[model samples]
Target: MDKIIIIDFGGQYTHLIGRKVREKGVYSEIVPYDMKIEEIDSNVKGIILSGGPYHVSEDSPKIDPRILDLGIPILGICYGHQLIAYMSGGKVGPSKKKEYGITYVNIINNNDILKGLSKKEKVWMSHSDSVFSLPDDYEVLAYSENCPIAAFKHKYKPIYGVQWHPEVYHTENGDVIFENFISICNCNRDWKIENLLDKMIEEVRNEVKNGKAIIALSGGIDSSTAAMIAAKAIGNRLVAVFVDHGFMREGEVESIKNTFKELNLIVIEAKDRFLEKIKGVSDPELKRKLIGEEFIRVFEEIAEKVGAEYLIQGTIYPDRIESGLRHSDKIKSHHNVAGIPSKIKFKKIIEPLRDLYKDEVRKIALKLGLPKEIVYRQPFPGPGLAVRIIGEVTKEKLEIIRKADKIVREEIEKSKIREKLWQYFAVLTDTKTTGVKGDERAYGYVVAIRCVESREAMTARFANIPYKLLERISTRITNEIPQVVRVVYDITHKPPATIEWE
Candidate 1:
C-alpha cells in the first residue's frame, strides 16, 4: 500500500492534508515537526510538508534535511516552501510585500503537477517571506506576478513544492491540482465512505463480539451517525441512551425520539435527573463538567440494566482536535471529549468517526441516507449554547438565544438563502446596550448572528447575508423575544475571531 507522511508544524490545517490524502484512497499519518527521519519507515512513497505559522528566518525554525535525501516524492506548501528554500542553500528573508489572502499566480512553466491548471490561476498564499535566492539544484517551475518562485522542483528528483495550500477550497483548481499529484504519484483512490462503513462494522463486531454496546444519542450528527453505525454493526444488541438535558435546543427531544423510531433501534430515553444536576452552576467549564458527570452516571445506570460492555460516541475529528486530542488548536471543551469523567468504568470507548472532519461526517451521513433535516443541519456545540452564551446559563438567556437563532433560520429559509451558506446561527452576548422603549430605559442581553461560508471548518470567511434578510430576522427577534433589545450581525472572519465567542 502506498503511504504518505505529513510533518506537522503546528498549522491548524496540518491534519486536513492527511484527511485529503485519505479521501484520495491513500493512507497518511501526521507526525511532529522535530521527529527524525529514522523514526519514519523508508517504505513511505511520499511526504507532504504541511503549511504552518512559522517563518523560515525565525530563530529555531524546524528543518528536517534528511528527508530530502530519501528521494521520495515531496510536496511543500506555504511555510514548507520557505523551509525547503532555506534548508537547500537558498536564501529566505522578509518580503517587502506580504501576500496574505487569495493571490493570483502566473504559472510560467506548466509542470506535471500543474497539468490541469492553466497559465493564469488564483491560489491561496499566506506568508510574509519570499525566497530571495533559489538553490543551484532546484528549478523554478512556476512563478506568480510578484513572487518569483511560487512553485519549485528539485533537479533530477521527484520533490515538488508549492507556495500555496491546495487543501483549502479558496484556491481555485485545488481539486485539479490534487488530482495531478495523486495521478503522478500513483495514489489509489479506494477509501470510499461505504468501505469505511464496512471497516467500522468489522471493528465494532470484533470489539463487541456477542456482547452489547451503549450509545449517547443526542440527536446531533455525531451521535446519530454513531448510533446508526453501531446498530448496523451489532443489530439489536445496541442500546441508545438519550439524556434529555432540558437545556437542549427546540425540537431536539422529539427529534431524537422520531429518528430512533425510524431507525428501528432500541432507545432508552433518560429524563428528569438532568435539571437536578446543574442547579446553580454558572461557570461554563463547571457546567460542562457537571453535565458530563451526570451523563456518565446515567449511562452507567442504563448499561448495568442492558449489560452493555462498550460505550459508543459520535466523536468526530474536530471534537478531538479542538479538545487537544489531535493536531488541532485548543478550542473549547466538547462534552464528549474533554468532559469525560475521571474514572469511567462502563466499558471501552469506541468512536468510528473520530478521525473524520465535519464535511466528511456529513458525507457519511448522506451516504447512510439520513434525513435531510439531520444531514444538512447546522453545526451545534456539544455543550449546547452554554459556551455560546458568554455569561451564565440562565433560562432567560437560553430562551432568548434560542428564539433569536430560530428567527435567523426562519428568515434564511424564507429568503431561500439557507442552502447557500455553510452555517448561520445566533449567539447571546453578555454585553447589554441602552435602549428606549415606551420612554423607559431598557438594558438587556445582545444577540449576534454569525453566518460563515466555508467548505471545511478549518478556515472560514464571513457570509454576505442580505440586508433584507437581516432586517426580517432583527424584527422577529425583537418583537418575539422581549428579553433581547438589540440584535447585532457578526461580520468577522475566522482568523481574527472564532465562530464561538467563548
Candidate 2:
C-alpha cells in the first residue's frame, strides 16, 4: 500500500495529519522530525512536515537533508513551511503579527497544492514566523492578509509548503487540499481496516505463542476491541479482566459486563478496593498514578491465577504522545502510559493498537464485529471521573458527576446534532454557587458541560450545540441533581482548554 510519513516536530496536529491521510484510504505513520531518511520504508510515497510550536529562527527541529534529495513529494505546514524556506536559502523571521486563528488567504496562482480551492478561502493559522523571501527556485502560490507567503511551491520540484493547517477542521475544504497533494504523489488507496485487523490478530497470536493472555477490558472502545482481537487470536487461552474502578459513568459497568458476556470475560468487582486506593486524593496526577498502580496490582493477581504471560492493554498513540513519549511534550500523563508501575514483573505488556488513533481503533472495532454502541462510544479519559472533578475525587463527587453526565448524554443523544459531536460530558467544578430553592438559600456545587467536535481527539472545537438542547441538559441536571446549583457550558476549544477539566 502507498503510505505517507509525517515528521512530527512536537506539534499538536502531527497525529491529526496522519489520521487525515488514513481517512483518505492511504496508510500513514508519524516519525520524529530528525528521523533518518534511510529508516523510511520504500512504501512511503510522500512526506509531510508537521507544524510545531517552535519558531524557525530558534533552534527548531529540521528534517533529514536526504529527504529532499529522495525525489519524493513533500508538503510542509506552518513551522514546516518556514523550515523549508530557511533550509532552501530563503529568509524566515518573526512575523509582526502572529496568525493564531482563522484567516483568509487569497490564491495568487492556482497550483497543484491548492488546485480545487477557491480564489480566497479561510484557513487555520498557528504560527509566529513567516517566510519573508522564497528560495531561488521557489515562488509564492498564495498570500494571506498578515503573511505574504501563506503558501509556496518549488519552481520545478514537487515540494509545497503552507503556512496554515489544512489538516484542521477550521480550514474550509481542508480535505480538498490533502486530496490534491495525495493526487500529486500518485498514491494508491489500498489500505483497509479489515487488513489491519487480520494483521493485528496474527501479530497477537505470534506474540502470545500459545500462552495464556489477560486483557484489561474497561468496556471502552480501545479495551473492548483489544479484548475481542485477543480472543480471536488465542480463543479460550485469552482471559479478560474488567475492574470496576468505582469511577465509571452510570450503567457503564453493567453495560460492559452484559456486552462482553459473549466473549467469556472474567469480571472482577473490585470497586471498593479501587475507591479505597484513591481516597482523599485531590491531585489529578496523583489520582491517575494511584489508579494505574492499583490496576496493575489487580491485573497481576489475576495473571497469577490464570498463569497468563502477557498483559494486553488498549493503549493508543495519543496516550503515548501525551504521556511524554517520542519527541512530544507532556500534555498530561494518561494512566495507561505514565501510570503503569515499574514493578510489573509478572507479565509482559502488549499493546496492539499503540500506533492507532481513536478513530482508527473504532474502525477496527466495527470491522471486528463489535456492537455499534461499543464501537461508537465517546472518548473517555483513562483516569475516569477523577480527572473530571477538578479538585477532590470522592465518591460523592463521582456520584454527582455520573448522574449529571448521564443526563447530558441522554439529552445530547436526543438532539439533532448528536452525531455531529465527538464527545460530550459533564464536569463537576470545584466551586460552589448560591441559589434559592423553595424560597430558601442553598449553596451547591457548579457543573460545567463540555462538548467538542473533531475527527480525532488531538484537536477539537466546542460543538455548536443548539440552545434548546443545552437548556434541557442544564435544567434536567440542576432540577434533578440537588448537589448541582448551577450548570454552565464550556465554550473553550482544545488549544485554550483540554476537553477534560483536569
- Among all candidates shown, the one with the greatest lDDT: 2
lDDT tens digits, residues 1-502, model 2?
A: 7899999988878888888888888988888887897898889899999887787864777888878878899999988888889889899998899888789999988769989888999889988889989877998999988898999999888999999999988898899989998999999998775578888999999999979999999889999889888989999998888888878888888888888787777888877898888887778878888888988889889898989988999999878877777666678878887999888955478899998888889888888888898888888887787789987677788889999989999999887798899999999999999998778899999999999998777778998888988899989998999988899999998765767777
Cα RMSD of all models vs. native, in order, equals 3.4, 2.0
lDDT of 1 by residue, 1-502 (tens): 6677888876667777888788777777788878888887854777888887677764745646888888777888888877888888888788788887788988867777777778888887777878777878888877776687888888788778888888877887877766777776776665565557777878888888899899888787878888778888999899877776666677776777877775554544444465456666667667777777777777888888878878998988766665665444566667787888889876688988887787777887888878878877778776676667776666677778777877787788777777778788888988888875667888777899999987767678888888988888888887788777898999987655666665
Candidate 1 lDDT (Cα, whole model)? 0.77
lDDT, candidate 2, at 448:
95
Q: How high is the lDDT of residue 57 in model 2?
A: 61
Q: Where's the lowest-lDDT run of ten residues in candidate 1?
A: 263-272
TM-score of each: 0.87, 0.94
Supply candidate 1's per-residue lDDT for 328. 41
